[model samples]
Target: MDESFVDGVQGKPGSGLIGNRKFVISKKNLAAQNERGGEENIATGWHAIEFLLWGQDLSETGPGDRSFEDFVDGKAPNADRRRQYLTVVTELLVDDLAGLVKAWAPATKGNYRARFEQGGKESVRKILVGLGSLSRGELAGERLEVALNSQDQEDEHSCFSDNTHRDAVNNAKGIENVWLGRYVRADGSTLQGASLRELVAAKDAALAERGTRQIAASVAAAEAIQAPFDREIVGAKDAPGRQRIQKTIASLTQQSKDLVAAANAVGITKLTLVQP
Candidate 1:
């Protein structure tokens, strides 16, 4: 039930086939699923749902094409099981997000959100640490370098949908949103708060501007790359696509360094750029 099922939906296009839908997820539930804690919880999260939705990127021309009927009342083997799994997983996702919404809702008290909002410097340090760690280790080293070194499509972050490029762009956007202290909520409302950008600028405006530019450059580098990072690495021996990916990696690395500087500006002097 991995990616090979892509062949089943190749010719079909929306006859209860080959389309995508949205699902809300609970972060805590997601973490538990990923951790599994040496238990029976199979790795279930966005990628798990993505696999069930898109199947796999078996096609060189485009993304996966999973059929909705695979999970509906049908003659297909395991149809009932598939339908039940999808329903339960999606319900879990919705329940998780409901918890988040309650935690972060305006005027909410004594939850994670209140603690984050109240502890100013601690929250800022946490944000910088996350941004720096993600850029330096997860995105730059693990995700990009491993794929580049092996030229393996399976290393892609969104391999099922061939959407790793979008993932990179969106990650950079998230970094930007944190620095700018602005983000659009799931309900179409805007949320603003104390930002790292303002915090840095209070001490050194040039450093702040440099960090902003580095973030933008990282995103631009990601966007400039051609589609399907897993496929693009195949051309590393001849084509220029590899160079584009390399450029994006460099951009991410620099942005990560900038994040460390920003963290230092905020008095968190013990930060380290982890690599894994």
Candidate 2:
């Protein structure tokens, strides 16, 4: 008598319980009986119908229930009649359910495919852009190295071996100005070109003076090296040997400073000495 129960099993195949042949329940009859029953009684019948449709026990019966025995013994309602009843009921409701499922399939499939394609395209674009940037960086580094080397060659050709003192001084100043210009441009600084050139020239002159002093000290060091060592060198008391070593080290240091200054005047920023 439960209409919803009939609706639930509307199109499902059934096991025969009423006869040897298949049968289906009437939806109108089920609905009419449900309307006539008391509310509590209708609920009980609905529960029983659900149990039967889902292959559950109608009562609190165990696996050894006599109802199952009686059903198998051919003493119950015809199996075919029960089966046909369930089948017809299911047939009536399944069309609406199937239509609902069909309506959702296209949208779900379309959205999934769209997302998959979008993700794939984005991944490819990211890889291409990264490779492009890396290529550009390598090209920029090579260009910078070539520019620095070219600048060095031009300085050597134009500024080396001038006869007049004025020409030599002007050329050294020009070289210093060029170095400063490059530095300021590289650093994105806002210094005026004229001022930068003057400042760089002054710095170069000071460095040159220091280099001359270092060269003089180096000549002294060479002479000291050639001198013969005494068997017993005399010194003042109270760690005189340590004091003498310290004074010698200081003289050698002054010579190093003068050498560094001389190198700077010629725009030689680095020096490597190979000792034999």
Candidate 3:
């Protein structure tokens, strides 16, 4: 999904600096293409919605400033198409998510959830792999390090909305939730139970404690990076914002190592993760 968004923005930026398809691609061409949701090199998905909502991020200290009037038919170019595209793409996203929910539903008799519950060690390994991938390869590397190294505002994730800071915070929070086996519902309720932390603690209590602390440190550092992640990656090498981001990156890196240790503690010897 992210790859498709990148291809669209960087390659076929059609009508606007953000975009409005070059030409509408049919659903037939999109089949068998998971995450690669495009034909004729068009962009769709989260970034497309973001582009429509907030054009290009031309400002130095803020995000794109697309006006609501743009969606008011006849007030802006491609207003009708914009509305139609939004509806279609949003529905597709929701549909895809719904499928995932059903697959993971606890009550499902023979879905992925059932298979996973019986997977045991393999399931635990998969969980650690996913956490490792997200923490190091995705969040720390592609999202943070890329922008930090480039110092280009466009490199920032969710650049259209200046929400990269929140992205990092939320991602770190997700890792924490999984480690602690806790989830907070939209209704302000939280669910907690046995988790990766407990599993690691069973073998090595000190390692579990270290992993928890490191995860918390990463969350704190990510939260401290401030809004407008573009700004945080710019200025002098020792700038406060830059330093904050660096700290977050460092914390995330260390936590990835801690996660590897946690995995090993749980008897998963084959710990393989992509370099961030």
Runs with alpha carbons beyond 4 Å of true place in candidate 3 = 1-22, 25-42
lDDT per residue as tens, model 2, 28-91: 5444544354542231232333334543212221211223332243654444444455454455
Model 3 C-alpha lDDT per residue in residues 1-276, reported as the tens digit of each score: 242342223354344312435545333323223244344233445766676677678799999887787668888656666666666666776777899999999977999999999999999999998888888888899899999999998788898889999999999999999999999999999998889998999999999999999999999998898888888899888999989988988888888888888998888978788776
lDDT of 3 at 183: 96
Best by TM-score: 3
Worst 10 residues of 2 by lDDT: 225-234
Query: What clash count does candidate 1 reach?
Result: 1
The segments of candidate 1 whose C-alpha lies over 4 angstroms from its true place after superposition are 1-42, 72-74, 184-193
> If both were scored by lDDT, which would come out higher, candidate 1 or candidate 2?
1
* TM-score rank order: 3, 1, 2
lDDT of 2 at 256: 41
What is residue 96's positional error in candidate 1, in angstroms? 1.8
